[model samples]
Target: MIHNKKEFNLGIALLVLFFIVLFAMFQPLFDGHNAMAYLDNLYNSISKGSAHYVDALKEEAKTLAGYNVKVTMNMEDEAQAADSVALITAAGGTASAQGKALTINGDYVAILNACLNDADKLYNNDSAALKAKYPALAGKDDRQAVYNWYKILGGFDKELKKQEAFAQAKVAFNVNSKVVETAYNYYKVVPEQIKNKIGIVIFSLVFYVIYTMWYGFAILFVFEGWGLKISGH
Candidate 1:
């Protein structure tokens, strides 16, 4: 028994329209992608746009030029150590592998420049250039090359810090975290400015907040009109 027929009917109408809109949201109406996917990509692109720190890292590396560094880092395996040797030598640094222990000795800038170059290529989706530059990475995934760089640079950072080479360590840390890691994770994502998509960005955020509240109110209206309430006995 509905205590208030008009309120109950209004609630029913609101719920009916709510479900209709919800069904439409699941359809591929936004440039061949559903509403959720479109919004997800939009946010990801915005994030990737601001996450590029490769160029800045390049500038910072210049400060460390002629700063020779010597650090020996342990690798996961002999193959990784061998790969590290190839990478370091290609960067104009002398490197040797003895079992799983790899040693690097050279100017810090030379090593860092090579890392920034690789990061820039991956960030720009130029795996072809990266592979071409390092034939050692031929017949294999280019991203694996970047991952090897990441591991090598990370090892360099730890060894530098332990030796109190803080300036060199800081640069290495930024290269691995800001440049290499970001490039790897956001590979192939086309970045976009939030200002360019301001309209939809604002609309989606507002709609998501209001829509859920609207549903709650509709349910409350229905229950109240149907004579459901707390009472003191």
Candidate 2:
């Protein structure tokens, strides 16, 4: 009867050991979906925020372009006037009185002010200023020099808008790349590492349990053998 009880106890222990090993080996498999969900959320948040920031930066660049045009035109005319004055001063009244050159103060002043006010409008984001500035260049094409200046200013504005668009595209592309990279690292790489570590731990415990079970069986078998011999069975 005692020998039967020992065999039943050993069987029960082996069954328990099998269940424990299986549970340990596969526990983390259930967490797979959960980890993926978190990674998706992180990707969405980063990508959305980055897109918004890029749009805002592009708008700012466009505004800066408009503002720069006005400032540059005004400064250029001012420099030309200063150069004329410097020449007159250096040569005394003789240079000014020379029939070889002339400076039209009225036209230059009008154009210079027009450019300055337009630039200020861009800075202030005033639509009214844009409307007011464009018409100032109309029909007064008599000042061919000033008209050329206006053309240059217009070209610069167009280039600036192009730059803004380019910048926006660059920012969006970089943001997307970063988000994808982060998701890949977290979900694919990090989870793989976690799974490996857990597998190692489970395997170690399984072997330990197997060893214990073997020792238990060996001990029981030896004791039974001794009893049988003592009883002369």
Candidate 3:
């Protein structure tokens, strides 16, 4: 009775320990998923919010470009000959500002895309096509001067596409960064090193259990050779 009681208690203790270990192993996996999901949503919201600002910048650039063109056309009229020089100067200023805004905004989008490991190759190819269509703008040191309302209005569809692509890339980059950072932080505890250690420990315990059973069988055989009979009821 005593021997059987001891064996029963040992088995119960091992079963409890097994459950505890299993919980420890799976808890992190479950929690990590939750953390990742939350972070992804957060970054997606941020990207969506920032998209408005990018759109605003693009609109401002287009507006200034349009104003500059209007002023330039007005300056060409004989009725405005007396103020032509002043209008020309104003148009030049607007062009310079518009160019700077477009360049800065485009670069900002490109940098964000690069962060996400995306090169925005389609945008580059399309921009190249635009440049090809307007060779004058491509060759001029002052692209703003050549990218007047006439040129942009002539290819408004392509210009709009380029703007949309830039905005998309920027948002994608922000979202990707959030996902990466969240995963990195959440999985730190259950990293490869910890998993490897757990695997080794499990294998060692399995080996120990097998070896112990083999040794017990060998002892039983020796006892039988000595004319001892071991029986179980």
Candidate 4:
């Protein structure tokens, strides 16, 4: 029941070409990576490139110099407690662990710098060095150590708020959010500037829009050629 043979034939041709392009996209065409996966990695690298603010954060931390804060962080277990103690002592802070409780007293800035240093190492994908420094973490995933940092810092933030040392607590929150979280999530991703991949990035976006429309138009042409129409009654 074709009303226009030429239009329906044109639609079939376009629809066939669309499937061909889609099938090609799913192939290992770009350096053995499918187009979507390559683009996903490209965007992730670009974002990680600009997301490094640890150095700047370290500098800002120095402004909290001379501020002494004390908090007893409650950890999940003795193993985690021992790990926290190591991190605190490395930052030149005094930490004593009893059972699962870790008492910390130190210049918040110095301690913050230590956390940043560890995060920087992870961000650069130098997990071997991080594991080497912490003997307890040997043969274990390095992210476990970073997660300890996250938990310990979260403890610091909550305890500081209780003592009404809001400024110092704010510092903890910022570092946890900005540096520690980013490093943990983007682990092993080599960052690069988006401008370098501008050509491919733009091409992908444009192709996405055009290809979507191509499918829609093909459907519309086919329906119209079959004398189908929407009308206001």
Model 2 per-residue lDDT at 7: 58
Candidate 2, superposed: residue stretches over 4 Å from native: 1-3, 29-233
Better of 1 and 2 by TM-score: 1
Identify the leading candidate in terms of lDDT. Answer: 4
lDDT of each: 0.88, 0.37, 0.34, 0.88
Q: Supply the global lDDT for candidate 2.
A: 0.37
lDDT of 2 by residue, 108-226 (tens): 22333333333333323343434344443333322322323333334333443565644433432332233322322222222223343456446656976886776676556545633
Stronger candidate by lDDT (2 vs 3): 2
Off by over 4 Å in 3: 1-104, 113-233
**What tens digits encode model 3's per-residue C-alpha lDDT throughout 23-140?**
6544535436443453344444434333223333343333222221121112222322332222123323222122112211223222232222211211112334334543444553
Cα RMSDs of all predictions? 1.9, 23.2, 19.9, 1.5
lDDT of 4 by residue, 38-114 (tens): 78888999999889999888878888889987999899999888877888888899999899998999988888998
Please give the lDDT score at residue 46 for candidate 3.
39
How well does candidate 3 score on lDDT at residue 76? 25
TM-score for each prediction? 0.91, 0.18, 0.20, 0.94
- Stretches > 4 Å off in candidate 1: 230-233
Model 2 clashes, total count: 0
Query: Candidate 4: lDDT of 143?
Result: 83
lDDT by residue for model 1 (1-233), tens: 99988888888888988899999999999999989988888899999888888779999999987899899999888888887787788889999999999999987899898888888889888999888877877888768678888988889889999999899899999999999998899888887888998999899989998999879878888988897986797
